[model samples]
Target: MEDDGRGFSFTVGSSELVDVGRDSGVWDVFVQAEENAPLARIGRLLDDVADRKEIFVYPSITLGATDVRPYYTVDNDLSLEVARQN
Candidate 1:
């Protein structure tokens, strides 16, 4: 991951060290929600770095909080997804 004073960016990889290309899965990225706030999709990652060879964009901004940050999640991450969605 990297921050260029304009935004946050990063690549996606398998935590299991397996191939993420064959499946062509995408990771749903977001900005971490704070109290009384909502989660928002910033961008997504398609497959792994080798598979897509693309740079995902995540524009950074102040969420009026002191510790807000970016978040990356796979499909159906209910713990975070549900709370934010509801």
Candidate 2:
């Protein structure tokens, strides 16, 4: 997350959702996974991205738990935009 005291910004890479506000300069990025995806897989993905870039990663959460079933979701969203050549 990047901020200028008065506003906030988010940057994201491929395979994520980037949301840009028209009036506000704020942006948000997020990736949602269905219940079928495993929690370990999501952690690996976050680890892989962090290894490639200098970024902050929030923890993952388990939505529900049971003896035979479990669920999880990403708590933080990232924001990104394409770079323009000069």
Candidate 3:
């Protein structure tokens, strides 16, 4: 899981469903999110490098745990379905 600078489990986007965090190099992306920014800082410090990809818009976030849900909404509506366990 990626931290949104506050050490909280940061989700890259608005999709609520939990995504498999296998060795897909995703963590690398998060760690190197902004190469131009310092590796450590307060309030969403980000440094951009030539190869860094812009992901999160905000930097600082309240430190918290992200409780995994059993399901996610299929659409912007209230409809829901159970998430399959690995």
What are the C-alpha RMSDs, in order, of all predicted structures? Answer: 15.8, 18.7, 16.4
lDDT of each: 0.35, 0.31, 0.29
Cα TM-score per model: 0.23, 0.19, 0.16
Which structure is stronger by TM-score: 1 or 3?
A: 1
> Per-residue lDDT of 2-86 in model 1, one digit per residue for the tens?
7667655566432321232232223345565457688866634434543221232233333222212233433312111111111
Candidate achieving higher TM-score, 2 or 3: 2
What is the Cα-based lDDT of residue 38 in candidate 1?
88
lDDT of 3 at 19: 46
lDDT of 2 by residue, 27-47 (tens): 233334447654322222445
Q: Tens-digit lDDT track for model 3 on 1-86?
A: 77567554444452333344431111112233466965532122245432222332223222122223221122211112223343
Candidate 2 deviant stretches above 4 angstroms = 1-21, 35-77, 81-86
lDDT of 1 at 43: 36
User: How close to the true structure is residue 58 of candidate 3, measured as C-alpha lDDT?
Assistant: 24
Error of 2 at 22 (Å): 3.2
Global CA lDDT computed for model 3: 0.29
Model 1 alpha-carbon drift over 4 Å, by segment: 1-22, 43-86
Q: In TM-score terms, which candidate is top?
A: 1
